[model samples]
Target: MAALNLTPSDTSTFMLMGIPGLEAAHIWISIPFSMFYMISLLGNFMVLFVVGKEQTLHQPMYLLICMLALTDIGTSTSIVPKALCIFWLNLKGITVCACLTQMFLLHTVTAMHSAILVTMAFDRYIAICNPLRYATVLTNVRIAKLGLVGLIRAILFVLPLPLLLTRLPFCANRIILHNPFCDHMAVLKLSCGDTTFDGIYGLVVSFIIIGSDLMLIALSYGLIIRAVLRISSKTAHQKPLNTCTAHICVILISYTPFLFTALTYRFGQGIAPHVHIILADLNFLVPPMLNPIIYGVKTKELRDKVGKYTSRR
Candidate 1:
């Protein structure tokens, strides 16, 4: 069915509601998001620096961590700054191309993240389950292959979603995006033509592309846990588990809300506009906050290393 663009009737649009109940809720939202933007920049840049500087961490695991941190940086930077600008400044107006570009980069990077998780899962699986094969499996050649695969897979799957979105016809009401960012479903809702194709294409991307990536990650962890159990020494088992723990936790937190948002849009409450808004914030804000804490704080090597690296005169 064709999605109706929001006319004057459907919009009590609290998109730029300023604040929830306070005097300047706009400033309130902008403040926290601004703080988050800074933290994301600092945390991820520290991660990149440590990984780059310390030759001891020149292994595949740290390399992947660097890449993951970079992805988090991209993910947060892609959406949050524009959102803060719209909220704090009076820059509420985004063009069709800008909106499409924002949505495209957001999803493209997100897709890369999911694929990276899949690759990291394999890395953990090999390091634990097939110790002898770990080096061969995740060699620089193979890592290069995985990186190329992730880049290509993300572009191949998610680029179409936004390209399809641009084909949508907008009526007179192309003004404010319901969410601060040019969210895919939110933008699709503005389409003057049938949104069925966009919705179907997005659903396929979600379930087949991202969902499949999650499943493979889970399977890798399954084999890993099995391998850990088969090991005789408890400490050895825990070592591998310890490394995988942060990644697994980040993956779960990052993904669950996104899938919930998708479900809420397609099958759950018909009020996608509000649910979408809340989930959009969570999807953007929560991960940037969570990634540093969950991933960085886990290992003493990273903690002490970053601590010393930053504390330098």
Candidate 2:
């Protein structure tokens, strides 16, 4: 095999394969992707608008929703534009520095999204289990602090990832990324130097960030279930449980594909390249496209406010 580059540098440009082995269908693929990206943008923007303008929504739960919306926007915006460019415009080449930048933004926003979900779980836990102290426990100050924690955690952990990858040497015949977007693993796989450390570091970070978030979210729901069970009237239990439905849907949408993609990357050696790429895209794209719809429909107050907001505009 011919070497692609002598060393990883700012001058190095990598080709982005919109969807490997499916080049003939790229035009058709772009249609759905463009639709999703547009919808994700509009939907998330609506959530932000409704949340920001509606004073009644100035609570912890809605605030967390706003955070989630922002995370979705950030994650999708970072990838979808470039992916679309690759698919529609056939502008596939991206500089090493640019690729790393996209990777950093995508991964950091993803980590932040996970952290936000954990915080939302905590919010629901307090709301359902200790209704009396819900407001007191999740005051604006505390919520702001939690947001800060999410940001700091994402910055600290994901910051080193691109930096590490930048240090690696490239020896492939051509720097062709199999995925439309600059995914961390997809990019790392092209390196000539030892990539074992990158893989391990990614796994460690995933376990620490996503695994812990999932565990805590599960724990929160467990406590919530126990509390709900204590209520004698089914009506009373349903009232509290209903409040968590939207969040649960959002969590499932966000985590399931993410976990599937990460697992397939690590363990699914026999899996098709296109399948892995699809799962990876879905992990980022589907959540953004679905989250706002789920929230808009499942949340009565947000739904009503959104209706009123749209009517006026």
Instruction: For residues 272-298, write the lDDT of model 1, one tens digit per residue.
Output: 464556566768777866787676788
Candidate 2, pairs of clashing residues: none
Error of 2 at 101 (Å): 0.5
TM, every model: 0.87, 0.93
- Shift in Å, residue 40, candidate 1: 0.7
In model 1, how large is the Cα lDDT of residue 78?
83
lDDT of 1 at 266: 67
Candidate 2 lDDT by residue in tens digits, 239-311 = 8888899999999898888777767878999998988877877777889999999989999999999999789
Clashes of 1: 3
Alpha-carbon runs more than 4 Å astray in model 1? 1-24, 232-236, 263-276
Cand. 1 Cα-lDDT: 0.74
